[model samples]
Target: MKLAALVIAAACLLAPPSLAAPWLRTRGLGRVINGTATDIADFPWMASMQILDNSGCGASVISSTWALTAAHCVLASQEMPGAYTTLRVGSSSRASGGVRLDVAQMIKHADFHMSTDDADNDIGVIQASEPFPLGSSVQVVNLPGDGYDAPAGLPVTISGWGATATEFNPVYLQRADMHVLDRDTCRDMMADVATVTLGMVCAGDPTMAICYGDSGSPLVYGDMQIGIASWTRPGCISTTSVYTSVGNFRAWIRDNTGV
Candidate 1:
């Protein structure tokens, strides 16, 4: 009955209001990646994977051997040991091309709290068995230099293997073009949460925003990646996506990832 127990536990996680339909809205503006089937040959750091064949997410290569993703994704990965788990990066789509990296270790942020939906420190690091190839189409995205503030309205690229609609993981890694939103507006939207700290930034539109499966998608501005896909409380349709602001926690990330 292990399988049955696991299934029941999974259902309990889904009981959160964030997982409900009212909070789930779909968008069509992003590029889609088929589950573990995208061309990331150019960005070996932007890997894709499926957790229990349900949630689809992306990873960022922080160091030569380590990749970063959301802690929520790590928790889901822990729940499902092996079920078509793979990592692909540096491609517009999973099918066309990309380098597939094998994971040797997964480290979730020590401060991560999935039960209370605390995404403040929702980051995780994945150590690949081997260093990714150093060449074209498979290089890591450089973290922004010191004191990099993500100015409002900068157009950034976000990609993920997340679902195109509610309760679905897209068949391809979806790439979307979005502009960064102001911090005050984002905090106002999540006013219910008394502690929306400086570590988070908001993005996406009211009708078309990141959804349930887009966790860990990078928010890159210019040549530096400044944020990570974190949460959608009011949901994807509410014009606010709480992101783990990399700029605010660069020291912490560097200390943990050592890169």
Candidate 2:
């Protein structure tokens, strides 16, 4: 299929605006493929990108006032702002009850360039207008310590509100069990599409993949947030979902957010 068609198909799975606002009572994505529904409290750090009133992407709380997400989710250019107006954090339901904070600032990596065939340095940070009151329902996720590397074949969990099937976006959050793939294997798989960088981590199964609206969601291993949902093959099936490695960008995140 054409890349555009794939993108459109992926977008339908990732961010379908027709669905009810996540906070409101309305029903929900194929992008989460073969995943199960989860409770908001399970992943309290989860965030939703609210563009106008619609939830289009996912994010994670790294500190009381800081969130981590994908660069393409928040940057129009080095000088322009992203499409999202707010970061809805502290909720797994995508909507429902969560602090909807105005995005005080969006700091994408200076080296990030989306124009490339691959989304290089596809990571960014969001500063909330105010600190989130950390509690049972709201909390911060631990970033990997220095020199940390995810072991290949290590099982991990990914959560998001992306489509569960073609044109289906869920009202509640979803989770899938996946495993880390060796970088070389990931690179070869992506050679026909985009260049796979060391800064990226790859995971997924033929039965499960990340699709459109899932961009920016967290890939959790143990209690640490290791990856940010970046991209996957069009149709979101039988392809490895790529993530921006949090361990690779730990220094950058600390320098920018100081937490």
Candidate 3:
């Protein structure tokens, strides 16, 4: 019965053409439900991207010169080359307290599409205008080594400063604990809505999810980042969310940014 409910919700995720998708397409759409508020002391690689046309999204610092995010996020800004003007580093609060730096270049996967109603490459990169000053509060995250896939049932953590609901946006960052869902299982459940791809991963808890401004956020296991927040059901119907798999894009990342 519970699974049946999820399928029904998934089918209607993009029911009407008016549905805002790619998970939190507008500024007011993002938030973390059932998450604990935290600070920069923990997620040193966290980045808050500020885009002009929409509520900004989250990102992960992969190298001093580059950060990784969802390509759709860049597309939302309606700009090419460099989309957003600045990004916040080592900050937990979205509105204050962080070293604001310029964005040098914005790169998105060429094959990515804005809708998750089907297959989506869904990954992109942000190059800082200058090198980030690495320290206790600002550091690059460890990338997945070689070809690695997170096994099903593996616990993961995701953090962001989005919104809790349409009526609530959090000032501080939030983190939630979840686990990887089996690829086959995820595909089965999401088939009615999205076409889960090899380059994507699915994860969530019955009570945990990323929303509105949470796109481009990182999904990590220990110090290794495995996924990038991409999409979820509309209206925040389910905690289950789809992510861009970092493991599947190693060659692409190396080619684009040499990270």
Candidate 4:
């Protein structure tokens, strides 16, 4: 009965939408990650996960009615369900001006265990109450397919409404460019902190890393989303930060969302 109940709950989350269809009509040249503020259209897939009208984590639209985010972002709300109330998409500013959608369901990874030191399988999918309007400022991002791998030293973009400085939250979206680090290097960097598992990807620059509120943000390479911001060193100023490997969980995502 317990297994049956868990299976029934997982079934309710459904699969994500297909990404073969293009949703974005325009692309901005401005780079994200450790950069300046971005226009709403700059990263159309970007979504803001909010609780009580305040932005708490970042997400990406996978379809009109589905989104991808960090499992930990919705962990607290899993039991209460009502804790997470809204998802704001198609906006660069977190404070205002976006299409707000009610969160109907949140599906976290079954293997996810927050108390574990590694934070393995930290991905989640969210179903919105309605489809997001497709336009120049709103769209879905492509996920990395099977066998797709991000080689170390590869540059990728990270975007979110996270704090620009310690304890300094920003109203506008910010982005920065970071390079993928090899597993060995990542393990070394995080040796004193959390365990860097194969299920996670590591990226960051010497001067920049994902800070508070950046959790669940996308790490993009070309047009494909490669990772989701999972955790950072205590100060968020570490030379490296870990991300939940989207490629590693692509099959799981497809199994859950069918996309």
What lDDT tens digits, residue by residue, belong to model 4 across residues 8-127? 111112111231101100111111234567787879999988765677678899887889988867764564344545899877888788789999898999987655254688899988
Lowest lDDT block of 10, candidate 4: 1-10
Question: Quick one: best lDDT, which candidate?
Answer: 3
TM-score of each: 0.76, 0.84, 0.86, 0.84
By descending lDDT, how would the candidates be arranged? 3, 4, 2, 1
- Candidate 4 differs from the real structure by a C-alpha RMSD in angstroms, to one decimal, of 11.2
For model 1, the stretches where C-alpha displacement exceeds 4 angstroms are 1-44, 52-55, 81-85, 95-97, 165-167, 193-195
List ranges where model 3 is wrong by over 4 Å.
1-31, 53-55, 80-84
Clashes of 2: 18
Tens digits of per-residue lDDT for model 1 on 1-259?
0000011122224224444222222322322222233355534457664344333566787778877777766766665545444566556664446566666777777877654334577677777777876566667788876556687888876666555542243445555666778888777776664345677776665444555556777767754788777766432444556677787767767877788
CA-lDDT, candidates in order:
0.58, 0.70, 0.71, 0.71
Pairwise lDDT winner, candidates 1 and 4: 4
Lowest lDDT sum, 10 consecutive residues, model 1, at 1-10
| Residue 57, candidate 4: C-alpha displacement in angstroms | 0.5
Give the higher-TM-score candidate: 1 or 3.
3
Report clash pairs, candidate 4.
Answer: 15-257, 16-257, 32-175, 32-176, 33-175, 33-176, 34-175, 34-176
